[model samples]
Target: MRIRVGKHGNSLGFVIPASVVRERGLEVGQEYELQLTSSGGLELLPVNQVIWKPDLSIDELLAGLPQEKLVYEDVPEYVPMGKELDW
Candidate 1:
């Protein structure tokens, strides 16, 4: 886990080993949150969800009224649609 600080263009970074990367099934272009511990240790955490939260007014809600029904398909009694199997 000892990585040397290397120059990366205008920034500096540590080279993560391929064995560690493959074992964790990590990919390129993925972002990880780094935490600095009081004991001088680095911890990497993966970000899963990024949700957009916006403030909406009553006028915005009224304008977003849909003309169509939310569910267009008929529900069958035998099939379990919750499992997400597409017919």
Candidate 2:
């Protein structure tokens, strides 16, 4: 585990042994969450999901940003074409 921290441009980075990386099936560009433990240990864990990021809203989605977007995007199937609902 004990890998030395190296300089990565303006950021600091470290190298994991190929054996460890290969065993874990980790890729070079794969996302990971780094944490500092109270016990003075650093943990690099694979990110299952982005924890720090907020869920994207409809307005935020690029597809929904166009002028042809609607508040209710889902097509209602209750009333069929050429037919009316009986009350």
Candidate 3:
């Protein structure tokens, strides 16, 4: 896809196509880090982008953990001392 640079106020800017925006999950007013590649090509990367999988369940998220490590062998019983709130 080709985009032409035009004047925006006192600066030159280009419009990002809606198709590319939707594909990349880009949001309005989101900041990006502009970089110049070794080959001299321009690259834009999302700033502080988080890689998350919200669809994963708790069990699925912990599937990689060893079974033995999941269980606590022994835990001291809680005893309420003076001035401490007891439930």
Candidate 4:
């Protein structure tokens, strides 16, 4: 499909049709790697096959971290002062 490259802020961009986006399950904030093919074509690849979603659990998020660098520290309880809203 022919798409027009138009000015986006200070950069140029093209719009991906909604149909294509839905078919590919693309997310608005998902990261991708852009590559230039030898035949002068553009290719986009997801940085990770599994894109992070807001509903992911804390354990799921931490699973991506290296086990060697995992650290836990006890945080001191804070006393609210000056009409601070405490939950």
Per-model CA lDDT versus the true structure: 0.72, 0.71, 0.77, 0.76
In candidate 3, what are the lDDT values of residues 1-87, reduced to their tens digit? 889999999999999899999999988899887777799988778988634447989989888776664323333575556765442
State candidate 3's TM-score.
Answer: 0.52
- Cα RMSD for candidates in order: 13.1, 12.2, 10.5, 9.9
Ranking by lDDT: 3, 4, 1, 2
Over 4 Å off in model 3, which ranges?
49-87
lDDT of 1 by residue, 1-87 (tens): 687999999999988899999998777888867777689987776666434346987789778666676443444355555646663
Structural similarity to truth (TM-score) of each candidate: 0.47, 0.47, 0.52, 0.53
Model 3 lDDT, residue 66, Cα: 69
Better of 2 and 3 by lDDT: 3
